[model samples]
Target: MGAPPQPRAPSRRVKLFSAWFWLYLVASLTVFWFAVVIPWLVITPFDRRRRFSHWYAYTWANHLHAVSPFWTIVVEHAERMRADQAYVLVCNHQSSGDILTMFSLRKQFRWVAKRGLFALPFLGWMMAMAGYVGIKRGDKRSRERMMAKCRRQLELGNTIAMFPEGTRSTTRHMRPFKRGAFVLACESNKPVLPVIMVGTHETLPRDSWVFTLERKIYPVLRVLEPIEPAAHDHDPERLADAVCERMTAAIEQLRAEIEARGGLEVRPPQ
Candidate 1:
């Protein structure tokens, strides 16, 4: 199955540490939010694109992970992200924490996320404030509107980031990518940047509210070379498949490297 063993019972020490960690996280996060509220309100009117809001959100995420000893994030090939290019970023879905790890790339893109995420407490509100694009799941009208918005943002010279899987996978195996993001890239004539993430589902599952207490989580982020316009023949379906195939190969290659380095061992592929 290429999936890690299911969660085991937390020891008493783990339970205690998790409890303490959550409290510390919640309290510190409140401060992180409030600290930026004034700056956010001040910048919203002057900054037409809301780029500051985007930076604020990701900076908060990066700092949160930075302070937590439980997490060690390694972002590879970040320099591949250039400031001059506005790309339609195509990323895989691994876990909610993928936001923290992926967004740490700080690529200056507006996120395209599902509607329910905006309903989440501070995190969702941050997405709204950061001008992220949201689509209602299974709602055709909502999707159409979202596409229109993304197109406008692209024209305005803003990069767009999307998780084409639509939802997180339950295992190491990735879900099928939806076509919307690739369609947008073709329509806009922008490059498709594949962001591959590892080590999320094994630690932070979509259904779990509490993070693992005993295990230290290391999320690896790899940014491959952009799929240039010349590569896909301006076809969304072909582009989607090309991207999916490239990412799948890279994921397996990354797992092998991790194994070779004696890094945190991922479950072997079936």
Candidate 2:
């Protein structure tokens, strides 16, 4: 024994299945992007665009469920998400795959995405149509504009989804929560809903653009009990810490299960 025995390669059937799945996802996204998305963009008037945008988002998300391979998405404590309520929803930043988790909710919420995403052609236009508020982290003026828009959106009964870590982490360890989300909750006096997204990073890590598949590796979205902001408001840093701690614990527990299955360890991005 020169060395430990090597593992067998994936079977032909497995390889073929993966190929078909990739093709299906590409074809589906293309049709939806052009046929559905383009028409909605063209037909819907500027002031009334949100309705069409929401419909488009819902349809696209449902399409993902139809085309996804190898893994299922599980939502826990979903009752926490109420259609009648307006709250500030915050989650950890992981892979772009996390978009599936958010879209899977099928609820109408505006995203607070980085300005860069807003620069994409059709995607940027669609996001704006959907009433999404893009934030430019580089400029103070842009930061002020984003804060104002978020507050206004909340007032208008729209929920805002934000990633408190600012950027996706390469590792499982949670990054220091930023103060913007907490500040919004406090200033707006809206309830903050903490969401824990598990396993998305492993499903599609930051450095890799290729989609990977694994058994029982489905992603999980756990809606933790909401954190209601006091009328007087607490220190923004403290509120941010409390939210960060709760989500970090949930993610770690999930990581343990994957590790026990001999999956690769997800390290926090530096």
Q: Distance from true position, residue 218, model 2, in Å? A: 1.8
Best candidate (score: lDDT): 1
Query: If scored against the real structure, what TM-score would every candidate get?
Result: 0.89, 0.80
lDDT of 1 at 73: 73
Tens-digit lDDT track for model 1 on 165-251? 888887677789899999999989999999898776655666764566465756688899889765879999999999999999999
Q: Give the clash count for model 1.
A: 0
TM-score (C-alpha) between model 2 and the true structure: 0.80
lDDT of each: 0.80, 0.73
